[model samples]
Target: MFETVLKCTKCGKEYSLASGIYKCEKCGAPLDVQYDYDSIRDLIEDNDSWFREPPRVWKYWMFYPVSNLRKIVSLNEGGTRLYRMKNLEKKLGFGKLYVKNEGENPTGAFKDRGSSVEITKALEFHAKKVVVASTGNMAASVSAYGSKAGLEVTIVVPEGTPIGKLVQAVVYGAKIKIHGSTYDESLAESERMAREEGYYLTGNYHYRVEGQKSTGFEIFDQLRFDSPDWIVVPIGAGTHLRAIWKAAKEFYELGLIEKLPKIAGAQIEGYDAIVRAWKERKPITPIKEKKPTVASAIAVKAPVDGENVIKAIDESEGYLGAVTNEETMEAGMMLGKEGLFVEPSSATALALAKTMREEGIIDKDESVVIVATGHGLKDIKTWESFIKL
Candidate 1:
């Protein structure tokens, strides 16, 4: 009811919330969902009261893009715990280190956040089915939501997509399509299907991004409206990073919070798209590539929003960090040792933070929150080495 609709990030052109247009052809850039701040201000004035109403992410529905609450398909996701790293912080020698554990969501990862809104929007578009090319987690998420919405789900995964992700997707009753040798190939095939067919694209949909951004909103809420000094997020498709940065900016613009937090992105070295753009020292390039990574979920060769990811880092005064597969797995094991079980993709952010801290790139006293993007169960294949046979 309080929707202000979609606005192109580059051209400022506005479209109706129900328009179903995801990008701006006028400026050839991504579009973002905007809201009526006046209405949001009134609805979320007493944020604590809103939290008392629901144990899910939709509690912030007043600020998101969904028009009909009835169309929402959720797995009771988006209320993940923000963990205070005690011994791990002590071991890392950090004064204040925290992690937003996103694996606890209904389908076992953060993808549920975006997938929930995506399915709702698809229903709004009267879509009979939804489709996606996933490294693993997104496919499973789409399938779960599609099942709940009584729609079909088509999923494309890389040939080597880990066993757990494939199982999850199949269990949710998706038509699994295995494709090329890498994640990028599958993403391309999925996009082509959506373009040629009528299935709605969920991963990069503006509304999907709007829903995922609520994680950032919840992070602030969990912190009692205090923006952390630094936020390190795992960058796969750039949606999570882009959404968080957008949400923080909105919060600041709406006078709900003060300043935006410096948002750093973590990428595995083998499949670093945003990293290449950040290091180029040129105008941001078209996100393109062959996906590669041991932490397979974040292994994207090219993400659609490379420029936006770099811009978010620049605007927030943060830098890019890449971790090796070995480091990521170690970080995952370390997280488990700390009693936080998160997938390796999530570990990438924490691993890079550890690397940065040791390299003197990051100061110890700074307040930081690492975004653990998925649960460990999604990538259980990597756990055997670290956990001992």
Candidate 2:
């Protein structure tokens, strides 16, 4: 209820909350849900009970734009574990290292966090059907959530999407459509369906960004409201990194945290548009050709939130880089040794972190948290090829 308006990230245009618009009409850019921060601050100050609530997405309801808490379509997502990688720390020669394991969420990926909010909003708008495009993770997450909410879910996936992920969506009763060879093509088809068929579009939009911010909130909470020196995340559409940074700034402004953490984004080499843009100081350009990689989940050729992600990194004085498939596999093995099994995309965070530490871009003594975005089992076929039984 504290949400006041939807503001354009590019043109500074504003729309009422009831307008039901997700993008800027004037500039064709994404819109963010703006809230009454003073009211939120006062509410938090007056009530301390919410802090004692179980650490889940709904626990931070005040930060979300949902008008009805009871109607929330949740799979008990969020509050994933923040683990200290003591063994890796010693081996890698780092001062402090931790992994925010998002793999533990329902449906075994961080996409569940976004789907929880998106589905709830879908029902609030009286939507009977929802559509989403994904390389893998989001489709499964949204399918599960829509099933729970009794909404018809249509999933559009690119060819070569991991079978493990598609099976999850199929089991959840989603109508599957394999659209094109690349994720961008699948997204175009989904968008067209949303426009023509009146289906509620779900993906890396503003509402999902609101939900995904909980990853950062939980990290800060687990750290007892303290900010880490760096929080590394793998970027696909670039939404997760931007969401984390937005959460950090919100917490800092609300006096919940004293300092902001530097945001680091990792991408597979061929899908490194945002990283290239950051290094070259140029606008993000789409990768025209698709290259094969084990990290299919994060293999986005044209990141939807690339511009905003760059702004977040620049604002936080962070680093962005890409790593090879071999390096990612090694990183995945390293995480497995640490008692964590993550997909190649998730392991990219660790690969980038190690590279940064060795290059002296990241100091050895700084506390670091790598946001492992998905479970290794989500892409069992890819794991089978690189990791022998």
Candidate 3:
């Protein structure tokens, strides 16, 4: 088993693995799972035993935070393919372009990566029930994983949450509560309910982040342990970007990767707090107004971990940009022509890449990878409204 500890991202305070803490008590910052890389290095021994059998994220269990292998609640999440976009590469004049398709996950979204580990940790904590507040994709992922783990699942979402997402959560036997006007309000209520009822809040949990780190691992391994020049991802709560950043640092410390990729984030124009902060050169401030967007999955007004998102972007020597709803939809349609049916939110990566290339921010010789975080099937209504099917 890999040795691990908990560390606060903000204050750098470390805690033993036995602690049942989610956030840092001293500064209220989110906690991260710190692993003993030296021990893992000895276990790996420059071997590729992990590639012998299964094509799942658990193959990299040595890097995950869960101590007990038996408690892992997995649906064979991860192992998503990186599709080399020859057409886009030629058209955009980039050196190479690949789309990391995360839509292939169990719940048809990348959130499954985080939910699987978070649910496993919930069971390890002996939680009777697990709770989460999400706009869409995450709620469905957590509900499905929690149900499979035989734990009661509760999801709090805004009334405007996509019907497809809610249907998944409900069909998976989760208790769904529609609350507040926006995602931020619902998330606040969910946190309150978790504290009041003593339920494990898996949303934004450190283990969830650890689970997401597997994506970065897969990307590195798929590229033959060579880091890409840049990874562009769509950001809502910023967990994915932060998780990838953490994984890059961990791999570098383990001597597995020689370099780190610059991480860029794309957001919808009205709900782009992180981008606004980057442009203004100020601290991340939560967006107070919620706007309507075709990408309902990323219509988060107030991202819980906005500060860390800004930090990750800056540390990666990257910039954040916002795309209009029309641009996001156009990007999704473009990807669909390539047989990659992705939601508008997922298409934001492509949208931002197009913007950056047009603005000369990204050079022609740099290889870029865009993370498609969810399936278009989950947002069929949005797609149907615009597409002539």
TM-score of 2: 0.97
Estimate candidate 1's alpha-carbon lDDT, on a 0 to 1 scale: 0.81
Regions more than 4 Å wrong, model 3 = 1-3, 51-55, 159-164
- What's model 3's overall lDDT? 0.85
Each model's RMSD to truth, in Å?
2.5, 1.4, 1.8
Q: What is the lDDT of residue 27 in candidate 3?
A: 93
Error of 2 at 340 (Å): 0.5
Give the TM-score of each candidate: 0.91, 0.97, 0.95
Q: Write the residue-wise lDDT of candidate 3 on 169-228 in tens digits.
A: 899889988899776678778778777888888887788888898888888888877889
Pairs in clash, predicted candidate 3 = none
lDDT winner: 2
Name the runs in model 1 displaced over 4 angstroms.
Answer: 11-13, 46-48, 51-55, 158-164, 178-185, 283-292, 385-388
How high is the lDDT of residue 181 in model 2?
Answer: 85
lDDT of each: 0.81, 0.90, 0.85
On TM-score, the candidate that comes out on top is: 2
